[model samples]
Target chain A: SQQGEEDPQALSIQEGENATMNCSYKTSINNLQWYRQNSGRGLVHLILIRSNEREKHSGRLRVTLDTSKKSSSLLITASRAADTASYFCATAAATDSWGKLQFGAGTQVVVTP
Target chain B: EPEVTQTPSHQVTQMGQEVILRCVPISNHLYFYWYRQILGQKVEFLVSFYNNEISEKSEIFDDQFSVERPDGSNFTLKIRSTKLEDSAMYFCASKWETQYFGPGTRLLVL
Candidate 1:
């Protein structure tokens, strides 16, 4: 499995500040996706960036993928206390025709009021 | 909004016992997958089922593991002879293109 490795295992930010987390994979990917898990609950899909796309935004979330570097970044702007959660990056490896994903260890974000 | 649903948020079983996890995928979704996450670990894929059969499975999905779509809506994962290491969070996901995950079943094999 081509699991992505996330940097800065934990992050802390004040409300209204921006939060960014980076993920790196060792293999080529068909697409990269970001998911958020509140506590031990299920994962919520945030965004997906294809190998060809550079950047994408959904509401206050921005995802940037760099295929050449095999890395991606997730940015959350104007963070709120409710946004505190563990964010994971998953990669759909190009060699995996079934589209099975490999997930990262996740970044724990703490948003304080 | 349609989403995947799972039953029995938690399950506790003795070692060597059998356990089955159930999931109901979105009506329109075509692909169903199973993943497991141990506490403090990343989620790992177990298997992917489509067209009423298994399309792919990982090394971790061995003879002890099996999956089935017994009905049009329900998908199941059965673990034979659960081990202590099998204690983890199990998630079921459905995908048309992007996947939607169901709340996981926390399995505790003692």
Candidate 2:
């Protein structure tokens, strides 16, 4: 089964608008993490929400996790052109090695000025 | 702040040749991981290392692949014989609580 699957494969928004992307997973997880990648670059760790936590915030990023539903969402508030990048949700399974992450098909966000 | 780092930003090798990708994880990090992304696909986990041994590996990691932490800070992935399908960006990561990824090494196997 796919571990992480995100909704809305692509998104385009104007500056100052909000961008929300949803993700679902198939198994129990210790933590869910969000990552950002610019074109042709490595992924940058954004935020991590543990199964015990419902929601988390960091700067302009807000992440919510619903373990009961096996789902998570990432909301980028006040989007900016610089926010154009691919966002991915990765899960660290409770049964697996702690750092092994299974990533989802990312949300391609295009924040136009 | 400190971060993971990798060598050979890009590598082009012929199929069947051996290629070794190197990474220097965060000095204090104890867990290290290797992942790869084929151009348009999701990032896939290849293997994880801790205490100088492999903790776990994915199916994608076969006999053709091997990993080592020969020294204290250097971790490496060696593909015994490259294949066309091996072309992708290989990323090395280190874990504290949050994983820190290094700028990936893009490999092109022709």
The numbered model that scores best in lDDT is 2
Model 2: residue A81 alpha-carbon error in angstroms? 0.5
Error of 2 at B94 (Å): 0.9
Backbone clashes in candidate 1 total 0
Q: Which residue pairs overlap in candidate 2's backbone?
A: none
Residue B32 alpha-carbon offset, candidate 2, angstroms: 0.7
**Over 4 Å off, model 1:** none
Whole-model lDDT per candidate:
0.94, 0.95
Clashes of each: 0, 0
Q: Could you give candidate 2's per-residue lDDT for residues A1-113 as a string of tens digits? A: 54799998999999999999999999999899999999999899999999999999999999999999999999999999999999999999888765699999999999999
RMSD (Å) of each candidate, 1 decimal: 0.9, 0.8
Alpha-carbon deviation at B16 in model 2, angstroms: 1.1
